[model samples]
Target: MSAPAKASADPAAPGERQGTRRRRHKGIAGNALWFWIFVGPFVVGLLIFSYLPIIWSLVLSFFEAYNTATPSKFVGLRNYVDMLTDHNFLSSLGTFTIFAVFIVPLTFVLALALALLVNQVKIARAFFRSVFFLPTACSYVVASLIWKLSIFNGVRFGLANTVLGWFGIENIAWLSTVDPPWYWIPLVTVRLWLQLGFYMILFIAGLQRISPTLYEAAYVDGAKPGWQVFRYITLPQLRATSVAVLILNLIAAYQAFDEFYNLVGNVNYARPPLVYLYSISLGSIQDLGHGSAGALILAVIIMIVTLLQNRIFGFGKAGD
Candidate 1:
């Protein structure tokens, strides 16, 4: 049939193909430009503020530096040695350990409990959530002041003492009572109040993610409605969130400063590592090398603890 009438060359097809390639090229270029535009500032800021400071501190830690201006001498490991041998540093570590031990479990339990309770509420859920979370909006410094001046003030008229007075107990020095560390009342309470809602929100988000079908299945299997459902279904399902909350609480506890600083106001007994470092570096002494060394040491301790916690929780496992 005349070679199929000499099949007509389709000029439109080639044009369409070229147009598609050009569109794709433009799309890729636009995406790359936008990605850099969005991420460039954050990357630059992180390097300038976070990574640079960490590197500079590490370098300073190895020398006898003062005020980060310059190294007075090449002390090698002397700064680390001094920090390790210093009694005050050791005491701060012990204090932080105790605080973390108490605060971590307490915050985890209380936050989970509150989350469960709030999740169960049939009415006014948003109101209750806001009420619980409002305190977190307050600055730590302001909350510490409120706790110190209004609640746990050493005076007879303070709220805590006034309540005790109603119970026929005399006013007590809540902050100054180092004999039994009654300062922990304000310190721990403020921290709990400031932090509990945040963790509770985490748990609530986690709880919402759990499949309702799992609870139904449990119920059909004769699991009871309340704690049984939670124990068998909710708690097990919340492993990741729980681990995160616990680790965060642990780190916060170890780094505690504002509450203690404001409530105790420079007392020596209950200082955490940050406060100790501050006293040495910027406080009266101004020893930048030892401060940097202590900070690095504390950072190592926190990292170790976090890794151990992650291991215990089996984080990064396939199913987890």
Candidate 2:
């Protein structure tokens, strides 16, 4: 009778353990259900809106789609062939290349300089920072329009012309001529004004993160305040930030469309890749096939460049 009672008690203990496991499993299942409830909509939306379009466009690139919903035929790589050989397309690429080369370094230098200056300001720093960063909130289209209509317009009353007139220079049509390529002035300045503050903010953050004790130690070892301290301590410490800024600058340069389009408006000169591809979508050249091919090519190029930069720079890692 004692053995039977003891065995019956042992059976209850096993049942209790099994019951606890079932409760734990139920709790886990309930938590998982809530997690899916939160994240499922966003994931589904992304797939529908973003990923599906990308995949569809890729398939569209392979077909002879000409201003139609359904593709006419599978033309293989002919669209890509035509896109690569296009004169307007080639020239647009050249324009992008030149713009990237000039703007990347210029923005980097100017942003770094502004960062250094702003980082040193002890009083009214927030005021100066806000003033500089306010331009970033302005639309590129608005800025481009302002530059075109008020600042760099060919009229003598234009700000740039008025300033130049003081030096006895005649009013020049900034966006009307390809001979002098003066359109680049407005294009470059508007972009710089819009973007510089953002990069400056980044550099400022990078600067703030540097330990003050390093500078103190350098001072104790007879390192002077200006270039010596900057070159050895500041510059070296900012390598990661520099790489990030340069990568961003390069991508921004290549993706430039709003300023160029708003400023020039289908002009023969200085048309970027986006402008050329867009032109293909409108007005006498509505070949959707080739345009899709060009877009994919540009996308691939951007992806490749980004990957290369990441591989070379080793972002978020310890630098040599």
Candidate 3:
């Protein structure tokens, strides 16, 4: 009773608190409105374009759908069975597997080497980066055309053949010859050129994120200046980036279509799954069910491979 009035009992204090709460609520509502304004379109677009297509494709894979205007009949797993037994589909899978085996390691090593080289440069770093990365900006279709018609053309005067001529070697048909599958040379080279710069940039970003103090500590412990430092420190730090690059490279290799389609034209020797599926679904007699089934199978294979890679790499683990 004799004590001074408490601060909480002040007449103005409750009104001030209420005013502050009102301001906070208004601020939160305004922020929420802005967030939805910015993000709503993207969410709507993803649902309509990406997720919906995936769902529809899954549904279509179960039916006996063709290119005709007639309604599709449900044939359950027949399309999937046909895809499994199809010779062309099997050949395409084999072709893609071989391509992946070659391209994955080649790109990984070359990209890492280029990244290391570029990272050590003391001048014109941006210029060097741009030069390496410029090819990636070129369309696959355009690049394939250049490689096919200009560089590896079967004629005696083609760029590759001309270079061989200078060395007293006979002109080679780089694309059409299948006795030894010489087409692989141009395909591999073009893919390497197109993708090397991208992976190099990724590695460079990974390198930059590595703490310099680790290198300093290694030096203090009498570590050597070159391979030892990289072997013991740099490589370990790049594990995550390496995993990502490998996975991406694998998927890209599996999905390879533009280069093969443009370079080989109508040849059936080097077709990948997508090319085969395209012929099935849209070429001649269209079979949308078989195409959808093959697509889902390819998607499953990619998913399984990626998961296995992640498990092997221990990706997402705290120390990894």
Clash counts for all predictions:
0, 0, 0
- Candidate 1 global lDDT: 0.87
Per-model CA lDDT versus the true structure: 0.87, 0.89, 0.90
Give the alpha carbon lDDT tens digit for every residue of 130-150 in model 3: 899899998899999999989
lDDT of 2 by residue, 239-275 (tens): 8899999889998998899999999988767899998
lDDT of model 1 at position 7: 34
Tell me the RMSD of model 2 versus the true structure. Answer: 5.6
Number of the predicted model whose TM-score against the real structure is largest:
1
Looking at model 3, the pairs that clash are none
Cα lDDT, model 3, residue 197: 96
TM-scores for all candidates: the values are 0.90, 0.87, 0.89
Return the TM-score for candidate 2, rounded to 2 decimals.
0.87
